[model samples]
Target: MSKSLLQQLREMTVVVADTGDIEAIEKAKPQDATTNPSLITTAAQMPQYQSIVDGVLLDAHKQLGDSATDKDVANLAFKHLAIEFGKKILAVIPGRVSTEVDARLSYDTEGTIKMAHDIIGLYEGAGISRKRILIKIASTWEGIRAAEQLEKEGIHCNLTLLFGLHQAIACAEAGVTLISPFVGRILDWYKKDTGKDYKGADDPGVQSVTKIYNYFKKFGYKTVVMGASFRNTGEITELAGCDLLTISPQLLGELDSTQGDLPRKLDPEKAKSLEIEKLTIDKATFDKMHEADRMAHDKLKEGIEGFSKALESLEQLLAKRLAELESRESKLVSAD
Candidate 1:
């Protein structure tokens, strides 16, 4: 008889599906869809996406020549595979898709910028305009610098793996299209640190996003804040008035089935009156602030390494599949 929690949140925030699964995205019907290396790697193993995986590998071998080494094939496949998935997601969602560049390029400013351009080019080549894609990058100093340059070039970016105020402030200053401050991950760090469980408004993750949201609104920054990596429905609801929230399919299902009184926890009007001072974050200041905040420093590094490992696992998978395809082709030739 009443509006579902998801519907309530949508009225205040843009709902985005945080997944690489087409069916999940369809069911969630989120305005935007986001994919990372981990999601892509997981999707590659699914029986349904096997054809797409093989097709991308075959396209790699064809374009790079059969003599291309496994490493070469894997490298090419990674880029194409990300774009391939992004293209499919774009078909179902009308808003935009956040496709990440390689995590290995996180600390490399110039490399991140160059890859962002190439990714946008790939989308354009496929007839999808640049307007429909957000090039997601880490929130390291280098990554923020890269995003700054990309923004000037009209390439929107989603600064991800953000934890501390330093990261959020830098992102807002950089004029990023959006910033994905991980809500659940922050809670994980705090819980492990103090061995205290938190919930609802008391959740540390919820507090972090609220601070960033209020800070952004108070300062009148045009950069959007999209809270991500939610661990539960409470965290999502606490950030009710965020610019956006990229929710996992699990939470989406939970929210869809549950109906309750949902209230707007954050409002720009309330934020404007908060007396938060403007914090200037140059490289030195950012490094110092990052070092002081153990949570942000450790979590950012962990996130990057995790994504990098996932990417490596994906490359290995591609190489193994490539070898199998080659073997099948050789056997067929012998029979002929």
Candidate 2:
């Protein structure tokens, strides 16, 4: 009997779980796990995650004494939450966790770089080595530049919201550790505009990732390519041989249940056989490509906005909690 489709793909690609749900990740057994601000916010709302949040608050109280500012408490709380998740996830997977920097700092090069270091510091404080974390950032030119500097300091980066070859080339030039080309977001733009559905090799999103993957493989760039934000099983199956794919658990479970024949779709040999010529871009060339690709440019901005809003919501939640605690503390002091 032939091996399962998922089993076959496992040989060619590294499957990563794209989520903050630790239990789901444990069940899926993906080699790596990735979390963004939105995913983190989602996880915090779950009843199972209450203990993690409580632990963070308890630690913050112990460390800050009687005068912890709301912002300080929030930052410490988020850090603790990230590390707690990282710790749990590390036990189930053998690979790193892609923890994102604050989305609001996406355009601020120095701030993004500093926050990246701070995130690493929190992880190290938890006794987790730097090797097990990939500091995730938006794939803006600024973010890419920040990642470049961070990589030299022995910190790995996962460049997210990437939709164009310009972003990919910039990331590669910056010597980023990895780039996450969003497959579904690209498809979303096309689908919404044209009212057309794409499948098989005809998928624009799949093709975009394929182009980037092939380019990286052809040039022997050390930066890993991870296809992310997938829309369906077809998109995932089409890019089966990508270096890594951060898949949602729903699609993963779908793949797990299905028993179809899955072939190696993204072989380096096949990429080499393609007619794509070697290409490199300077700042001017990169700008021109960005100008030419409307979908990439629009989606990149939209993704950043969505993430920023989610981060703002998280901040508000933290602020409300802090205020309530402060009020309760004042009442207790009066009673005493």
Candidate 3:
């Protein structure tokens, strides 16, 4: 008998679970996993994850000694939580985990590079090799520049919030490890603006990723393209042979439960057969293209704002926890 549709598709593309929830990740059984500030913040709020965060803080305190400042402790605590979640995810999936840099440093190239190294340093301290972690960065030009340098140093990067070909092409030229072009976010912009629904191969968001995928394959660019931020199964099904696709657990469940022969929609051979022209753009051309594409520009800003807000929330939570700990410590000293 032939393999199931899911099994067949798995042969071509790497499926990554896009969640910080360990239980959901384990259930999906994706080859790789990705976590953003928002997802991590959501996971940290769950009662089940409270002990995990507490344990991380306990370990951070022990490692840094009681003299460690709250900021120091908070950074270490957040890293520990991220790594703990990553460790759990790595057990279920054989591929890398994408842990993001703080969104606040998206435009600060030097700071972004330093933070990326710090994140990797924390992971390496836990016995996880640099190979198993993909430092995620926003797809801004400065972020791309930071990634280019990092890639040369053998640190793999996953460029997130990518929308325009300018970003994709620049990333490809820089030889970054991978680029995640957001699909649903692009769709959301179009849907809200025009009230027109796209179907099957007609999705503008899917088309953006598809164009990038074909461009890379056509030019023999080694950088991988991972379609992300999917809105529906149709977008997922449309880009079946993408290098990778990070999906939410809810969508993964939807794919698993549906009964149909899922077709292979994106074949490199087919891409080559189509005689698509090659594209190489300098800064001027890139800027022009970006200016012409309203959806890409709007979505890119929205994604950055969304991530920035999530990071702020995480910071606020960490601050509150630190203050509580300080209050407890004050009381203990007073009692003594």
Candidate with top lDDT is 1
RMSD after CA superposition, every candidate? 0.8, 2.1, 2.4
Error of 1 at 34 (Å): 0.8
Tell me the number of clashing residue pairs for each predicted model.
0, 0, 0
Candidate 2 clashes: the total is 0
TM-score, predicted candidate 2 vs. hidden true structure:
0.93
TM-score per candidate = 0.99, 0.93, 0.91
TM-score of 1: 0.99
**Is candidate 2 or 3 superior in TM-score?**
2
Write model 2 residue lDDT over 1-336, tens digit each, in one string: 666656767888999999999999998899999998889889887989877876777677679876777777776787667678878888889999999988888989999999989889988987989999999999887898899999999999999999998899889988999999999999999999899999989999999999998988777788999999988889999999899999999988888878878888888877766676766767787778888999988998899999989877776776677677778889999999
Native-to-model Cα distance after best TM-score fit, residue 222 in candidate 2, in Å = 1.0
Over the stretch 74-184, how does candidate 3's per-residue lDDT look in tens digits?
777775677787777777888899999888888899999998998888888878899999999998888988999999999999999999988999999989999999999
Q: How does each model score on lDDT?
A: 0.94, 0.87, 0.86
**Better candidate by lDDT, 2 or 3:** 2
Q: Locate the minimum summed-lDDT window of 10 residues in model 2.
A: 1-10
